[model samples]
Target: MSSRASLKANLQLFVTRRCQLRCRYCPILKGDSLMPLATALKGADLLLGHQSGRVRLDFGGGEPLMNFEVVREASAYAARRAKALGKDLGFYMVTNAVLLDDAVLEWAAKRGVLLEFSMDGAREDHNRYKSAYDRGLDPYAATRAGVERALRAGSPHFVIVVASPSNVRRLAENFEHLYEIGVRRFDLSYAIGGVWSADEEKSFFSQVELVLTRHARELDCGAVQLGNARQRLEPTVLNSELMVDPDGSLHQMSEWMFETTPPTGEAPFHVGTLDTVKDINSLRWSRFHSYYTLVRLYDGRPDVRAALLNNISFGLRVGRFFRASGARLGKVPA
Candidate 1:
């Protein structure tokens, strides 16, 4: 599908705010509440029942697998709904894979859900930043176990190696290690919060070039798809990323872009919810989020205002990197 089509068809339904890991680079809102099964069922029905045709549903959250029961049953409900209506349902769940159990793996294979595994390149780097809150537990070990299991099960999977200041220079090395471990699909993700220096950006681009060169070199052996390099950029609003919080409140993807926690004290850009939004196509979307809006909306909280500004800055840097490289809209391959 075209980038615009993808933007139009996608929906991010967050299952739970609870996660096992307290990653240094994560900015997602955290809580113990899982999206009620009724909410998930309703959300799926509302999304798939629409006239939009094929629906690509990404179960978003603080480790979707942390809320395993909801993820399992809700996904099944969506599949059944789609089949009954003769519609295509592209199911996906992005996970740390720490809680990826046998049942989830089996369900993914049976339902054709594309499982996106977060293995931040090298083990040291992964364990360093992507570590669980419990220091004794090695997140890398669990990630490796889950990924290897998925590989053995013939589960559709991809590796998301985040390139942050902590490990931007080691990206190529991490990429190599992952490729050695049967990672044919890669999303060389850039950490999207504040404080990327000019030097860090330069190093990041250089590492990306090296990784691309390696991919080109290995083409004769087999296809190793670089997920971000193969996208088509476009001027878009909310279609590409719309997240429904566990409370059934819907917001654009940008509102959650931060590091460690939500800076605004509350989520921004709440478009609508499943309760009231019958047609997503009818929602009013525009350039509603900016520094000006932040200033206006967050007059009382300077710290919140400052953090949000940093987020915007970081986002623009990533955007410029993609625009300069001409990777269509900087999406991880549609």
Candidate 2:
């Protein structure tokens, strides 16, 4: 379908704030306030009200699998509503997989929930970075078990790997390892709120681009494209997806939506909540979000525009200055 004509195809709904795993880089929770299940259901209803016939919802959470009952109940309700309203229904779960179980998988299969497992690579590679020093549980094993369960249930599955300074050097090995283990689809996202700095984040992006460019043929053998937060900035993909938080806050993109730090201050990222947005233009459209949006919105105002231009210029100057010094600026192939 053409971009303009396409109705929103997907939605990510945060069903709960609770999680079983304590991954080091989770950006969702501030403390421990879990969104009530009633509120979550209302949020789903709000989304369905907005795009009932066309939207497919993906269950999200601190660990979506941790709230298996909510996932199952919400799916059933949505499916029934969609069917009655003559709208299409689709479901997916973004899970740590630590708490995924056969009963949950069976229920999901019956309700038709697509499963996304957080498996970076082999147990050793996955554990190296995933182990929560305080939690003392193996995330690698938990993820592996979840993937196995999904495979057994014959559910479509996706694997997500978060790239950082610690993992960039091992991209090839990680990709190869997941492929060998029967994971056909995968995604790569950046680690948020970790020990990495801006330079490290930029370098990680460069490395992923280079890896894909150099090994496109081998890596492209997988069923899904390796994607990240920047994927939302691409115009072709924007209308096709939506990121709804646990409280039912809707975002234009999933990854960038969560990592959203307000233009200033300590806000993680987001302008407002889903309940408040009444039009398409209310979406957070950052100037540097993508080339298309940047060009379209560049009006050279005294405030917003000048600030954006200044920011861009400063980044460019910094890059040049870094090159002049002994600092490294990694390059990714086109």
Candidate 3:
């Protein structure tokens, strides 16, 4: 096992699968499943022990605040452990913002948890995609109130806009609306499952280019900084972003859990469980190596890298087309 530090700098804990809203494109398998306190803490401990330097512990879920106690406890524990071990620890969470309240906001503010709220576009767009589990509850209103409450509390947060085929045309309008509501930092994540036509793809990129250009202009004049743009412009490696599922199983990519076909000829995706692994560094090393190999293979190639970073649908199309060709070649009976 290599004693060299793993390339992973972030660990995402899917604390709970329970959520209050039913978003149309959510990938989370919503249920009552939640990570046990012991499991969450153990995963945190493992992450701190194995990874070096500054590490980010991200709490995610159908809505992580659904199991707020676990999030609170695990974050505090990780903070203390990191302090004693002389490590820099950062905390983050991804939530719909429908469940946020004054108490939650205050707690997260004191703990310095970077809360990311999901809002599609404006009122109509948001409500169309994200609705409360109970039809009577207005998700858009609730989320708006939550965002206001966080702003009042001076909590550190940002908005993430998910662009689907249905709402791609309204991307610029939605961003402008969010900006008007005092959201400075934003992330635009396009839905990967939808069928995007050629016209839709062109429109999507056009809108993205327009919005991002305007935001960059704003940033230049000391107006607002776009979080996603900063992330892209900054020099950062595709480090291992490990996901600890609710069952304590460690996986390399969150999407791997949803893969219909097994990764037959690729490196193993599931490394080990928190309770079973003796040397976490070795597991991290293996995962890092697998991803690094892919990065090296594609990073220097302009066509491949641009296709991957610019458009999700194009990337998926290329990936599937290549994988199918490979499978056919494997069955040549030579």
Candidate 4:
């Protein structure tokens, strides 16, 4: 590892592979295997002990609260270690909001941990796709209570809705529905790992236009901001977020998102493991970090290639729309 003393290390940990719901489009779902406490602590040390002056730990999961012990303990450990090392530290949790409770909400508020919620607009639409269809549980119903509690508790948070071909037509209605429920900020994203047809693209843009029109005033006032006008207009397959999986293994976010059915390796995505990596500089770089490389590595899989290209296409088109519509989008908070 290079002695980059001023580097910032931001590590995202997948504390558990267990989830309560089986969303139709999720690519990272797996059995209920939890990350051992020792594994998570080692991961914390990788960042806290690094030369980085600033460090952040973001926790996600099949459902992180399912392994709340690790999330809570490792986070506390990291905070203390970072403080002792005279490093800046921050935390965030990406979750479905189904498992939130008073304890979690209070802890997040006190710790200043940003809670990123994954919810797709309305109940009917959410349950239709994001539901635990196998268990006949309504995901929207399960998460709404927790979301409300967090809002009341004043937890630092925002909501993200992933729009796909299946739900593009209802995007406007869904965005409106979320607003009615008191969510003031959002990140609207197109679903990846699948195709979006011509009609779907047109519908998606129209829906976005409607959302902008309805929320224009709030957007201009910065009361409610769309976080992704800048981010959404690019290829996300080679995302920059570094991911730490349950087994203490590390990979790039591009590789981690598709963990369920991994792509053929033109080059390995296993950058390093927490067991050995002591600094972010020690992390190995993968050839699959580029769109061109991903295209070659994902050969013979036309669907995946098409989806990747479509995502980039969406970015360009959306960027045009943002400029033309004069939509005011604020920078997404870190």
Candidate 5:
């Protein structure tokens, strides 16, 4: 493995597993456990201490707003620590936006925290999968209101749309609807671990093309951000993006939810604990880091990178299916 002396790392802090909404596609449903303030600060310290350049710290969870106070304190601490260490820091939060109100928007705006909302398209499509536990609560309406509030407050925010079988056909319409509602930026993603039928796959690509064609101007002008398209077009070396769990355990961003038992069965994805480890140099980390470095070495060849990502995604989907089936059959090892 090469020296990570100059590499900047992105840290995702899963502040809490508590969320108010019951989104059908979310991997984590519910949990009362919240990351302690001390653990949150420690995780920030670990990232700042190990990385050299600008460190992007993202506060995420079932819903980060459930523990907004901790996020605020930790962000302040991280800002001070980064200043003292002569490193740059970027703060972000991922939320469903159901709880985003004027006060929350103002707080985040004042602190320069970039907010990203998980909204699936327009009201009808969005309500199809995401909603509150009460069943009567309208998640789509709340999210729309929240976005409007954020725009009124002049806060920096963006939208993330998850493309599933149900919503694939409406992708273009959704993008247009969001644009009509004053959302200028977007991050589009697709669901993994599901087998797409022939017709579904065709529709997915067609919708993607339609969206790209309709938004070509915005995309070219840098007003929109499509995660899947960007990955496919401009592939970069996967940097060490660390996911710090609520318990303060460290994991790769890709292996965030599978910290206990990675699907690969090679080894636990547990790189180290934020409380005990001073530096991240575990074998697993080293291997992944080196692999990404090699990928970057082929930067000019996007086909190679695309193929790599496709293969990896396929393998992960298979692994997910196997694990799910095993649990269903009572064959998962205890």
Candidate 6:
């Protein structure tokens, strides 16, 4: 890796494993246990000590609002600590929007929390997974209603949509609706739906690319625009704050960061608990760190110091298994 120092700006923190919505694609539902609140705090402390750059933390969840107390305490704690150290802490959460009642909206607004709501496309698309058949509320309507409530409460609202093949064709139309409703920042990501499989991802990636390009073209035409005049391009897949799992495990991205099935059968990764900084330190040179370190090394760019510490036992076996396995399976028909 090149010698450029690594800068860690955002932390994506997962606050809980319990969620109200049963989205088919969520990876946390596959995990075993939730991390305690004390453990989460310790992980935050570790990030502060080792990582350089703006220290922004994002509180994520099975439903962060479900653990509203944790959300409040962690954000407030990080806010105070970051400010005293002359660093900025950005706080936010991703939710299904079903849980955004008036009280929740108010609390978030008071704390300067930005809310990212999941919307598939239209009523049918949005409700397909959110409402399913058993729970028959209109998720599309609920999301719209919730957005209004949040905006009314003076909270900044962003719309994040996962594009599936079922709704890919209507990307522009759905986004236009959101833009008209005062949602300026649109995050578009490929849908990782249903069971995780290599074959499925191949097809999903192609479809997502096509849909994303189509939407990007509409933005170019300026048919619908955010009220802001900064002239920024819409973010297709932006980096978010680090995720703190219920177990106080630090994840670089969303809950999906822990989605791996280890070859050694050790399960996925967890950095450490919040109360003990030692768990955080013990994670040094573990598979987690090795993963990032190898990426930096292979990228052959300005090298950043690998703060990702992982246990070689788990990471190394998993590494060789994946590399060899992928090659062997590459020629198999998708």
lDDT of each: 0.71, 0.57, 0.69, 0.76, 0.67, 0.52
Task: Give the runs in model 2 whose Cα sits over 4 Å from its true position.
Answer: 1-9, 133-136, 193-334
Point out the higher-scoring one by TM-score: 4 or 6: 4
Every model: Cα RMSD to truth: 4.3, 8.9, 10.5, 3.2, 11.0, 11.3
Candidate 2 versus truth, CA RMSD in Å, comes to 8.9
TM per candidate comes to 0.84, 0.66, 0.78, 0.89, 0.77, 0.63
Per-residue lDDT of model 4, residues 227-323, tens digit only: 6654342455556567788998876676644556556656333466876677776564432354544665577677677777876677667667665
Ranking by lDDT: 4, 1, 3, 5, 2, 6
Q: Give the clashing pairs for model 4.
A: 233-315
State residue 86's C-alpha deviation in candidate 6, in Å: 2.5
Count of clashes, each model:
4, 3, 0, 1, 0, 27
Better of 1 and 3 by lDDT: 1
Model 3 misplacement above 4 A: 1-6, 213-216, 232-240, 256-268, 285-334
Which portions of model 6 miss their true places by more than 4 Å?
Answer: 1-6, 30-35, 50-53, 132-137, 193-242, 251-334
Model 3, span 33-106: residue lDDT tens? 99999999998898787557788889997689888899989988999999999988888899888889877987
Candidate 2 local lDDT, 131-221, one digit each (tens): 6434667778767877877776677666787665676667657767776767756665545333444566566556555655655564445
Q: Write the per-residue lDDT of candidate 5 for residues 121-196, one digit (tens) a residue.
A: 8888888878787767889998888888887887887788777776789878887898888887676555542445
- Candidate 6, residues 1-334, lDDT tens digits: the string is 2233224445566666666555644445533345566765665666566445565566666666667776677777776777777775566678777668977876676667767787766676676656533366666787778877776676776667665545556656766666667665555544432222344334543543453455454445543222222322122111223456665545544224324312222323344445543432233222234345234333432221121122222223323433443322122111
All candidates in order of TM-score, best leading: 4, 1, 3, 5, 2, 6
Clashing pairs for model 5 are none
lDDT of 4 at 98: 83
